[model samples]
Target: MESFNEYHIDPKEFTFLKSFQDNWQAIRDEFIHFIKQASNEDLKLVYDILGPKSKTIKTKGDAKYSAFGILFQGMFIEKYIQVHQIKYPDYGAEEASQKALVLREKYFPSLAKLIEKVNFNDDEIIRNVYFGTFHPGLDIKLHVNYNPHTNRGYLGLIVPEGDVAMKICHEQLYWHEGKFLVLDHSYPHCPHNYTNYDRTVLVVDFFKPDKPREEVIQFENEQVTQRMQENPYSLGVFGKSDRAKVEDFIKYGFTHQLEWDKAL
Candidate 1:
């Protein structure tokens, strides 16, 4: 708890963090290997762990940055892209970064035993888990997590060693593959990966300690990211919500692979 970082959140806050710490390496090694050797079988494994892509329980406006919020950040292509072999690609990244976005999904899990080994007895606080990959030169500008349905939870990110930069609560968080960051993403934060290689964080949603495991999973399963981002929950029809206001002040920077001689 030295003041190396601005905010001082005791690692003791989240009880499940210790279990995550205990198996971090085993989980990481298996995950990294699967991603490196991405294949058809690997893709199926990811599908098994994360369910279907159409049913990926990802929050709207995730790791990607945006000027206003998740809306203009290019996370959803279905709203705009009409033509495809039913493929809406993640565009705007430079030539070298194209593969990074697509390959992240092909590597969510390979160590099912290790993941299952992580248990909290009857607690079962982990609602959902998925891979949140950040590509080289991707800049995630400042934004806050918004969710009104049944408050109280944390956004857990298991990040690896990298030259990534994060600004949250006026402090910085250096990464270690073994470290499990249980953060309140509601605080405005920005993370920029200026490195050459792709950075992956095993993101998990840890709900209220007492929240019924069945209830948490049920709500998230029924509520897709799109529904959470529209109309009553969002869209600012009554007034300009925080998300409705354009984020003209968030710092944004991008890097291309051609600019660097090597990328890890």
Candidate 2:
């Protein structure tokens, strides 16, 4: 195999990312810290928890709202791929769903404890608020498109081998190091992979707030907005998003995630 030694990430960030791969508890702890410190108000917590960062990477398409979710360290994703017998072709969203399902089954009971540390109020929080995670392994790639208008992103990578490489791209974003280089999602980039190793990431979306009185009443009277959809890949097999009741939300839905849930 060609040694992509130039793709390695900095030791500090790599270490931090690694901590989450082996022990999600540590990741939860870090989130708790962000909650206690970064959040100044109740509503802000939702945004802060999901919002994008001001540093690390840059591309186009800045978001109207913030983007926040945890990206599994690459090494961890690799481990999940191995133990589960997950193949390179099975590294997309559906495969990730399977992994998470396994994870849910393996550690159902402990998730609540982890949630508690983050100060997530059981009553106020919706089940789907913390919705299921998204995992896209090497076969699944993310093409990040940034709006030329903003220089608000910094690209990062965390590879098992190679030195860290950083650059400014008006069009393309490549994964080179331990940091899964984050870029503005508004940009038009897509993930494409030809590698054998399965790469995975965690996608978390926070719950929408309770609507105000007038809007709630208006919404109650209105008909549901209908849109046509297609599921050619059978991705919906995971479960309905409506099933995301608050109690069900915290339960681990991805037992497959547990495949690599442990740090190797």
Candidate 3:
């Protein structure tokens, strides 16, 4: 492993960014084409891939001056935004991200394959972009506080070369290609730490297409930005209970046994 000062970012941070940047370009190009052509089918495909608008963050510092952690302050701001969404969804972009995180933690290796199957190849427009933000995918944020019970999922993929996953916990017990997860994310779950060199994955949240989008309020400048600070994971009583339940679900193993006739 490289020294923290050598790259300025810790190994985990460095790996996450490198993986994400590589993977997202491919998805972006495909999405850009869809945006330009505005084909009904392609537009639907884009919506399917990106979902609605994901969260966005304005950079607060210069990308050059900060060494290691210092030079790329804006990048960290975006990361914080992701964690904010994972922790707090009521005011965030989407509910899918946090839900997916919980699902991954609760169930082992269920959703990985479904996420991996996400490919933008069907769209002709995105093929040309070698690099750039051409994809219309929503920018959801994912936050994962360390948990001791289960294995944390790592993000990985073959194309566009960027990390689009939050805390992914790969499961060896139950996994099938394109059907690896038990639930779909409603928000963005950006990838964090891992051991692989080319660690990245295409993040796709599967949910009913009709899920309602939260209304967003935009501000013109920092005047509003200063007043607004991002908070991840709600701290309210209900929210705390929800988090605890997620932990409990992960701790207690799941089974298919159920009695349908009893309820009826």
Candidate 4:
């Protein structure tokens, strides 16, 4: 792997990369501290919590290119409906929402505690933790994740040995095991994996110290419920219009299960 200092990152193209580069050491140290405290067993606990729901959790992209994501949020979609007393006319929507809630509540508390330790600030509430996997040859096109109110942390767990890299604005970093990368996701970025193996990373999104966990959870659930109300398909799956795609989403939501491979 090449040294980050040897590479030139154009601030004009990657505004976030420039800021990150300037504070790379500090950020890296923070992540390293987190990793030292978190054992492999802790990671397994996270995997154990999310693994079964692998099928239902929505990943972005099409068959040609996709990145799987396991979302940990407060209030399962099912519970959300019951708590808010929402009555969905569509049976499919009702079932999906209920199922989503059940899965979320199953492991949310444990996952939240584990991730909270990583932030090193108990006051900073962890809003969501997404465990993502990118298959070989998957190229996530340039895009910006707009969340003005949160801080995002990326922990590289399983990275392929060859030519797989993530570009945050102007700078590029090759993936490696145990490497930590922090960024302001509101900036433009993309990922390219040229290797013949899968790459996995743990993404932690949290609110600032000012926001309490309960408030953050409430805000997030409201956003999720509103999205579902507007478009049932918007719940977890994205960009699908055809019947077959919809069926796949439904099937995955109900029975698509994934197990954590100890190797990863």
Question: In candidate 1, what are the lDDT values of residues 79-194, reduced to their tens digit?
Answer: 21121112213232232123322333333233333334443352445434445566667775455453322222222243435667665654566555666555555445566766
Poorly placed runs, candidate 4 (over 4 Å)? 1-124, 210-226, 229-264
TM-score of each candidate?
A: 0.53, 0.28, 0.22, 0.50
Model number with the top TM-score: 1
Per-candidate local distance difference test: 0.41, 0.28, 0.24, 0.46
Reference-based lDDT, residue 244, model 2 = 23
**Which residue pairs in candidate 1 collide?**
none
Better of 1 and 3 by lDDT: 1
Instruction: Give each model's clash number.
Output: 0, 64, 50, 5
- lDDT tens digits, residues 117-210, model 3? 2222211110001111222232322323211111122122222334322332221121111121222221112322221222223322111222
Q: Model 4: per-residue lDDT, tens digit, 1-264?
A: 433321222223323223323443443444334335646764443333323222222324542232222343333334434444443433444564554444444434444334445444444344454546677777765454544445565557666688878765345666555545656655545667777886766565555344566666566666556544544433322212212334434443343233123224
TM-score of 1: 0.53
The digit string of per-residue lDDT tens for model 2 on 1-264 reads: 322222222323222223223444444444445445542553353333222233212223421213333211111222323333433333554464455444333323243334333323332121111212112222222222222111111222112222222222222234432233433233323343333232222232112133353453243222111100122121111112212233332232232245446534
In candidate 3, how many Å is residue 96 off? Answer: 27
**Which candidate should be chosen as best, given lDDT against the real structure?**
4
Would you give me the overall lDDT of model 3? 0.24
| Model 3 ranges off by over 4 Å | 1-25, 28-156, 159-182, 185-196, 205-207, 210-247, 254-264
